[model samples]
Target: MEKLYEVFPCSETQKVLLATYTLKDEARRDQKVSEFQELKQGRMSVAEYEAKFTELARFAPHIVDTDYKKARKFEGGLDLEVFDRVGVQKLPTYVEVLDRSLMAEATLAAMKQGKAPATTTTEWRGKRSGFGFKKGRSFVSKKQNTRTSNSSSQSSGSIPVCSDCGKRHRGVCYRVSGACFRCGQPGHVVKDCPP
Candidate 1:
């Protein structure tokens, strides 16, 4: 029953970055949002955030060749926790809060924080009905699961493990787009970067 808005930044830029993208990917993208608290109601993509952060830095601080060096300087900039971003959707496509307790807590807190009451709220609906989360079954297809099982059975300790970090990272999968959702990088197989 945790609230997404309460813990995240008010800037949608940072919010979307944290929500849609990953900390590991952020450095590569060059979108630096070091602090989760700094997020506001901005919905620029991670690509956009990376672009703007660089532009602003150009005028004032100037650019350094070492991106890794810069990333290290910006600690706490990325919140890559799975729960923080699970079920996350990009802006202009915000999902409605279905949980009543979460709604009450956020609304009440907003009032005290000098925000206007959310007296008028819209219910979340998708393009098709009966197309939301359900407890018993997953949204995945049976064929997908069968295919995944076949692949894994074929690859018992015979392939690379770590999808991103490489070097056989334990417990994570190499196929993010496939059945292997190790640490959840989007498309690339963990063993091989997308080409």
Candidate 2:
């Protein structure tokens, strides 16, 4: 009787352990799926966002089982400006969508810097230069000329030219090659500069 009681308790404990293990795995998977579904591009660059999306996507394969579905999911997570630009293309494959999103990001950045106009999607698709402008007459000539004048004035100590990038600025040069003004790190801007 004593041996029978010990055997039954040991088997019950093993069963409980197995059930707990299964439940833990299912719970973890569920969490990962939830995170994947809620992923967004907020504040992150396109490459960072894409890497995270790929990392979490494996947990929820059914959500992106088809190429179209995968592309759509990726598109939906882009920033509003990039999404609007890329969405208009109606790209067929995930790779195409990803490529267009990267281009859109570059174009938008150029626009923000006054280097490109807010052109139609058709114009954007027509031609592109290394600086994300439509190829033709140099649109940057005016800006370059202004910078040259400013630099010449800076030589007389009237204006300040950033020694780091040779552009005119009043205070710390925060916009030079996207380096942090505080620490001079290349990957982050001033506001996101780490202590």
Candidate 3:
């Protein structure tokens, strides 16, 4: 049998005692002893931790997943060690940075009040809209994704438009503008842009 402390060393003494008491209460309240027997035996599945849960999007908005896919191809950029707690097999690009690693532990614990671990095809990212930069980083390319189109880079044109605000300016937008030699501003040449 696994030691209680080994199972949950982080729980406070009082909390652990209460959890055990609660489990006993649940056992008595279940009204289905045969169902409980399945759990006691190996027929039931065990719960998983946060890292694997988040990596695979198995858990709820338990944690945010960053666009690790946009990172560079370098080994340092493909850091998946952080998700080791849960056996999540995620592409290096699907990981997200979290403020607190332990937060997932709590979320998973609450969810696992005891359930089986099942493999799921989890889509951690949100659906696309017609706006905004495609993703957070540069590890992966859009050419490799669903929005695959020949990048604007391949199209030859005398000018470019700011993807944001759709303004017309030249010689670099004062802000994050996709400006070109034409129509990036209000009736003015970039050379004559008021200083």
Point out the higher-scoring one by TM-score: 2 or 3. 2
lDDT of 1: 0.37
Prediction 1 TM-score vs. true: 0.22
Can you tell me which runs of candidate 1 are displaced by over 4 Å?
1-42, 62-65, 73-144, 147-195
Give the root-mean-square deviation of each candidate in angstroms: 23.3, 12.6, 20.8
Worst 10 residues of 3 by lDDT: 70-79
* Backbone clash tally (model 1): 18
The candidate maximizing TM-score is: 2
Give stretches of model 3 more than 4 Å off. 1-83, 86-95, 99-107, 110-112, 116-119, 122-195
Q: Estimate TM-scores for all models.
A: 0.22, 0.55, 0.14
Candidate lDDT scores, in order, read 0.37, 0.72, 0.34
Candidate 1 residue lDDT tens string, 90-151: 11211111121123333444456664432121211311232322236544344554554455
- lDDT accuracy of residue 74 in candidate 3: 16
lDDT tens digits, residues 58-145, model 2? Answer: 9999999999999999999999989999899898888667766876776677567555333454433433332223356444444554
Instruction: Give residue 192's error in model 2 in angstroms.
Output: 45
Sort by TM-score, best first.
2, 1, 3
